[model samples]
Target: MSNSKLFILDDDRKTRDLLLAFLTYQGYDTTIVDNDVGFFDAPSPPPRTLITDLPTLLARMPNILKTGADNDLVVIAYDKAESARILPQDERWLFMPKPLNLDELESMVMRAQEYHALSSRNPDPPADEYPHFLCSTIIGKSRQMLHLFEMIEKVAESSATVLIQGESGTGKELAARAIHQLSGRSNRNFVPINCAAIPEDLLESELFGHVKGSFTGAYANRAGRFEIADKGTLFLDEIGDMKANLQVKLLRVLQTKEFEPVGSTRSQKVDVRIIAATNKNLEEQVANRDFREDLYYRLSVIPITMPPLRERREDIPLLISHFLGQFNRDKRRLVKGFSRESLEILCNYSWPGNVRELENLVERMVTIKESGFITPDDLPEKYLPTPSLAPSAPAGVSLPEPTGIEELPAAGICLNSAVDAFESRLIQLALARTGGNKKEAAALLNLKRTTLIEKLKKKNLQAS
Candidate 1:
């Protein structure tokens, strides 16, 4: 009944006849191709969907898909064994057993059509423009991430000290690397050291090289992070955890661009760019006198904060796709994608561990699932929606009982303040109930997702 077109290719004559007859009845403009001969050479507009057998599909591949030129086209391949062996890894390509159910095939076709229509209406930015990966690791398309990318570009043009602040696993180090990669000193070494991981006694020697017999186990002269990263960038991770004595020594280096190695008075001058990152609040640490105020000021010359995953839920799907592709290729798995329900739960759950957690989950799922789409049942118990008896409320909010206007205080109440409080409480409860899932929370509050986001932004309310 519609104008959607389909092309079928199969070596078997009977199979081709059955497909042609069934697909015609399904109201598709159908064409039967014997082989890749005329199919690739034909001048006619390419069909929206292509149904082929395993052999033919593999024989023409990369050419058939045309290296993403035919990305819009969906290809369904069927085989007797139902194996994904040697199947090209593509989201648009799906595999089914030879004795396929007609209804399921029809459903897949319909879903492909719908997806194509939606994509055409609101096309995503080119793969190159957004989802810019640093060493093929960091990736996202959310407004926050795009803004972060812009900031990285601008920051790359300068030599100012950079301080990256975010929770653990939020990719602060990756951002620092991105800056180095885009900077003028990219050809030079990029050295990284975790201040918290190393002991205070050894950290000084680690930062400033120790000469032979400088201290216990100092066999020979060695270059420190600063010396190794000369004319390059040194990423000091967990900067907030560095000891006060070491902080003073680090500050001197940042101030004068020179340092004396442990047990050596010879001052060495080095041109090294400093880029520090911390999971802790450095400003708070400085206020508490745990970190040097001068060092904090020096490191924060150009501060960059990475937003948490929950704050940018729009990027979850993109992150999942990126992870899925990566893991599939690495593990040699054929995980087509996640089910809609599974994705909804994943997008809503608070990723305390951030991108690292998501990547791990994808890799685990790909390893276990091996092939086919991942379903809700495949997720862990913690990720599943559980029934709660208590009234759902955010961590800092409590649900209030019904109150009557007659109970109004004699002193009178600020109506606007009271209304705002009530609205905020309800929003908090919804978010808590949905496990910080904005889409689910919005549904519970009877508000559009965008409207809920705006309210949360205006009130500065956290999902937790």
Candidate 2:
């Protein structure tokens, strides 16, 4: 096997020398540099990882990153404090607190080397799509989501108004924001106003500007969501919840690009691209005379419907990882990720609340839920489903056990055995998905770290 090289940067000569000797003894081609500048200017060492102390390391990272190392390059930061501060934690970066446990350090260094070797042996991510749009915020690879992304790319350049329709908590707002970001108006503001959140009396004033003495509490002339979003995108959320009177005014503005303030006679005009979203059925509301027909047509110019979370079950694991990383930043919980069984439950559960529900569930698991691998029971009662829908006994029906293991009756699998098998399979899958990070797996499973470990033990499973 080709030798792996490691570099050390530190202010203290003694510490740098010690690490250099230790790494050399571990069968590595090691180099010691006295300052960050020297480290940056060092001759391009064949694909190597770097280890250093934190004090000056972080201060000079931007420059070091500029002298880009091959993807094989990893960074490890060390400190003596009990809670070593690790900032901007990149996947290639590892952190260890000192008085360093030599064994753990060795294991970490070896693991980094192994990972680099494995990655180098695999195909690289496509260069053209390296920085995909909203790829960092929204994670999914299902055909449905891919098509949605394609549609977003198609509409990003045009100045067309977009209407995102979906069930509540399905991330309609996120979709709207994504559209704006990918469009030409990205540099401008994305003003969002929830029609259902504000009172009917204040909804009109909120959408359109109010002159100084327009209404009872209108003391000073105020710009509404439209004015603030001028030359930008205005997101009208819960548009279906707007009263009939407000709908007329909104429709007028869409058609005429002008509207009078609540109590002002002079009309105002603003070049704002309207992107409305709603969980309610505007067509039904229109049929029932609760919503205006003209308004519906105008708003539906570029309708983009977001699939409910349950409909796109394939995206659950990705969403779980995304949310876990978000919450784990502050929790400092060692919980690696989710166990398989927990993720199965999350995916199978009918997420009536959609993406919003899933996010809330993950947050609860990180903050107040049980620890270890998140188990089925750690989830909220609502997430478990009714007895009829439970994986063990479907529709309150029970199956007979196999007699003397005759042919191992496939139709008559025992509930305990079935659940166990399901959990075992899930754990294996989660581990494969996250490359064996228990905390990340737990997040994907929406389970606490401790609970995931317990479930793994019970199921007699080990992460690869």
Identify the leading candidate in terms of TM-score. 1
Instruction: Compute the lDDT for candidate 2.
Output: 0.72
Q: Report the alpha-carbon TM-score of model 2 versus the true structure.
A: 0.55
Question: Per-residue lDDT for 346-385 in model 1, tens only?
Answer: 9878787788888889999999999999999999876776
Worst 10 residues of 2 by lDDT: 399-408
Local accuracy of candidate 2 as per-residue lDDT tens digits, 1-464: 23567778777787777787787786888887666565555677546777877575665564566566445577777863411443565657677666655544664576566546545554644434533325356556766676677666555655666778888887788778888898888999999999999999998889887999886888998888888998899999988888989988887888688888777888988888899999888879977988876677667656788887766898899888878877877676545678888888778766667788888888888886434667777777666533321224343344333222234354555667655545655666666555466876788789999999998787666654
lDDT (Cα, 0-100) at 350 in candidate 1: 78
True-structure lDDT of candidate 1:
0.79
| Cα error, candidate 2, residue 15 (Å) | 88
- Residue 2's lDDT within candidate 2 is 36
Query: lDDT: which candidate is best?
Result: 1
Clashing pairs in 1: none
Model 2, runs deviating above 4 Å: 1-135, 369-371, 385-464
